[model samples]
Target: MRELREYLAACERDPACRAVLLTSSAGPFCQGLDYTCLLGLSPDKRRRAAEELARELKEFVRAVAGFGKPLVAGVTGACVGLGVALLPLCDLVYVSEKATLQLPYSRLGTVPEGGATHSLTTLLGHMKAGALMMTGRAITGSEALSANLATGLLWSATAYEDLIAQARQVLDNAAQIQALESTKALIRHSLRAKLEMALHSECRLLVHQWCAPEFQQRVRDLYDGGQLLLQKPGFDTQ
Candidate 1:
């Protein structure tokens, strides 16, 4: 995540960088958090990590959402949890036929991160957004396209080059790139402050929820059910 933060920071600061492109090397864009490590930290350490993680998430959202350059993502496979939370931040998204998006926050006994509460509602409307978050449902690439979450879905990865070329064009042409950036800022300036506040709220809520008694019990359940690492005999989860 720190690497991602640095990359986004570079995109914002580098004059030569006019556009940002995100892609995954792994089979899935993201499989979501490996909660096993987080669920294993000592209570004091867990609290510290959760607090820091919340701040990091807020900073990440602010950096990505406010990036002056056009941001494009090429999703090849599965995109779940935090990955699903991220789609709404990009200026454009292209997905492969196999790409799948899911939000499993409730299943993990937490609420949405990545400011999805506001971004999803704004992009997908109340009904659809509620259905996804409340029901913990996932959507396919084609379904994402139909839902306006993706610009397009490619049948093959060979088609991904075209999207990359399009993003490169933004970086290659200075005047056009600046114009696009200025236009984007003008359009989104008013919403920036609101998004910041919403992200701040999400971070704080998540910090508490992650360390709460219920969340501790849920993690224990994972261990008891053999879903996590070596279990400790006694810990005041409450």
Candidate 2:
């Protein structure tokens, strides 16, 4: 994720790159941290590593939100954990019809990282956000669109090409593209105060959750389960 941010930064500064499109590999968008990496560490080490990772992930999301050019995401399979939060930061989110979005942080005995709780509340309102966080529910692509979480849904295999075309169309209209970016900047500037407050609150919650017994147990469970553990709730191993 950190490397992705660096790459995007370079692209944003390049004259040739008009916009950015982010797509996952064949299976899933991203399952987040490797469980094996976490499992190999001692409990104390794991907690410390998670803290650092969470901080980096939050920064990455904010960077995406503040990117100068249009940002697009082509999501397929499972969009879980931070993936759910990252979608709203993009200018356009295209999910596969079969894709599922889940926020399983609470179930894992930790608070939502990647600013999921904060973004959800801002985008979907407190009631909807509360429901998703509290229940750790998974929403389908159509459901996400209806809820205004995604811009559109397309066939999994064709999503990449279709989203690129959409991006190209945006770039073709230079005047419109510039105006759109200006509007985004204005709105983001207005929301900066709120985003900062939410970020601080999120960090506090994350630190507290990291110390919880249930969260530690969940991590231990994953370690014991081996690679198959990635199949657990809120992650799309397939």
Candidate 3:
């Protein structure tokens, strides 16, 4: 999170950098968090760690939201948990045919992170966002496009190797338009304060939830049942 924020800050300062493209290497864009380390922490330490994590997440999301340039995301594969929640922060999202988005927060015994609690409702409406958060459902790329979550759907058998290239081409084409940055500012101005408040509330609630006894019990239950860390099995202390 610190690295990402620093890079974005550098890009924002560099006059040559007109826009930024966010993507991962081949395979799943982001498989989601592995809770082994956090779940393993002692009660007191866990609370402190959760508070730190909440602060980092809030700062990272704020950086993304406040970016002046176009922030485009190319999703080549599965985007899960916090990854799926953060997609709405990107200015444009292009997803490959195989790209899948899932918010498993409810199953993980946590509320939405990355300001999705408010942004998803604003973008996808109450019922759609509620169903997704309540049920841990997965949505396909085409479905996301249709639902207005994705800017476009990319189809390629090569795992969308050229996804970044396509995104760059689109941005380059749009560069000819007048006052792109100013126009983006105008579009985002009204919602900035609301989004900031939403993020603050979401992070506070998450910190409190993470420290609760129920959340700890739920994590243990999921881990014991072989549900947690099934996709990505590794401890992450950072």
Candidate 4:
């Protein structure tokens, strides 16, 4: 997110960066929180981290939604948690045919963040958004395209690579780049303020859920299952 914040700021000051393209060499575009590190934090440290994260998320979410230039996403593999939350904020999104969008907040007994609830509902409608949010299911790239979650499914053999190439091609064209900026601004004009509100609300709700019984139980389960532990080297739960 810090890197992204830097990129967004740089784009504004650099005419060479007329557009931005986001992709992941990591297996998933983004796996959201690193649970091992998160669970290991002491209470005070956790609160501090959460505060910083909340601030960064709010800024990042708003930046993406209101960015002046074209922003394209080339989603690959399983875009889990935060990745799913990020899609609707981009100016254009293309997902690999083999990619999947995973939403696990419900399964983990937590609320949504990154304004995903609002963004997804706005893009995908009430019923579909509710179902995904409540069920914590995975949506495939093809399904996402059909449901309008993705601009298109990258159907090529090297779909992720091709998606990036397509974004670059659009950026290279002066006429199309200008038109893209205009079109994005028109579409997002109504969403800018509301999206920021949702983002802050979502962050607040997520932080509040930290002490909720159900969410604590979910974390406890993972701890008991040996999937995570806090007394490892630098981190001390005590």
**How well is each residue in 1-238 modelled by candidate 2, as lDDT tens digits?**
6777777789778877667887765667766544344445666886887677668766777777778877878787777777787777777888888888888776677677766666778888898888888898888988888888888888866866776676677778667666877877786774555666677778678766765666667877755665223642232111
Q: Compared with the true structure, what per-residue lDDT tens digits does model 3 show for residues 105-188?
A: 887677888888888888899999998899998999888888888888887565355666665676678845337778778888
Candidate 2 matches the true fold with a TM-score of: 0.85
Best by lDDT: 3
Q: How do all models score by TM-score?
A: 0.85, 0.85, 0.88, 0.84
lDDT of 4 by residue, 1-238 (tens): 6667666878867776677777765455676654443455667777676677677778877777777888788777667777788889887888888888877787777778888878888999999988888898788889889988888778647875677678777776656666877888898887777777788788887776764455666877866885433332111000
Where's the lowest-lDDT run of ten residues in candidate 1?
A: 229-238
Query: Model 2 clash pairs?
Result: none
Candidate 1 global CA lDDT score: 0.74
**Candidate ranking (lDDT, best to worst):** 3, 1, 4, 2
Strongest candidate by TM-score = 3
Worst 10 residues of 3 by lDDT: 229-238
What is the clash count of model 3?
Answer: 0
Query: CA shift at 108, candidate 3, in angstroms?
Result: 1.8
Q: What is the TM-score (0 to 1) of candidate 4? A: 0.84
